[model samples]
Target: MFQQFRYFKPIITISLIMLISGLIISCGSTSSIPIPATPTKEVEVAVVPPPTPTTPAVPTSVPAILAPDDSCVNCHSDEVQLLLTSATEEVEVELSEGEG
Candidate 1:
């Protein structure tokens, strides 16, 4: 038993020394390697021209359009009537008529 322990003691000490040296080398300061510069090749991109503009086709059939009427206020007024008079001192705000 004593002879076997004596033989293994040197082997264990060498293994521990190697492991500690590996750890110390791995934990050293990190340095970045410089990369060699190379010339970049020019890349050609394909550009497509826009299509020629053309006059739009006119409507074959006329669409039925809604005619403006004052009767729409009967249900949309929320039962509240707003009176507008020329002599009234309230703020007058009127929407401009559309050309369409």
Candidate 2:
């Protein structure tokens, strides 16, 4: 009987050690409280209209310029008439008659 008690003493020692550690851990007090989450709400936006584009107007008519022979007559009509009368038959560079 004494032999059996001596053999079980180590098991009793280990059990007591486990029980003491459990008692020490449970002695602390702690409580968890949940926070209320805010909702993500979308805002309504107003639609803006686009601006109209302005058009540029262009003018139509253009003035005409005098030809080379007409400009020569405009500056010196008397010289042109005198040269026309004095020109020979072989002088093939002929002017338009009465054009000036």
Candidate 3:
């Protein structure tokens, strides 16, 4: 039994040495070091003046030049006016016939 235990003595000695070294390394001092301050630079800034206010021009009359035939102005103005006039005439004719 003593002969069999002799072979494990070197292995146990190596394991104990590694464990002690690891403990000593982990338990060492952990002091904080001071950092140096950086120098500041001066910057130049330009001041701008505010813009002056002006009156906007207002139109007193419509322009003599007409818009193109395919423009939305023709569709909204001419087409809508024709439909309104025809609808009023039809309503007037129906009222006259009903009265007769």
Best by lDDT: 1
Candidate 3 lDDT score relative to the true structure: 0.66
Compared with the true structure, all predictions reach lDDT values of: 0.68, 0.67, 0.66
Tens-digit lDDT string for candidate 3 (1-100)? 8877798889989999999997787667343334455767677677544444664555556555764454766546797676876544443344454454
TM-scores of the models, in the order given: 0.29, 0.29, 0.28
Question: RMSD, each candidate, Å?
Answer: 21.8, 37.0, 24.6
- The reply for model 3, stretches above 4 Å from the true place, is 29-100
Q: Provide the lDDT at 24 for model 3.
A: 81
Ranking according to lDDT, highest score first = 1, 2, 3
For candidate 2, write residues 1-100 as lDDT tens digits: 9899999999999999999986776655333335457787888787544444654444544545644456655546688676777647575677679857
Worst 10 residues of 2 by lDDT: 27-36
Clashing pairs in 2: none
Prediction 2 global C-alpha lDDT = 0.67
Candidate 1 overall Cα lDDT vs. reference?
Answer: 0.68
lDDT of 2 at 95: 62
lDDT of each residue in 1-100, candidate 1, tens digit only: 9999999999999999999998887667354434566879788887555454665544546445645554766755644444432246888687778784
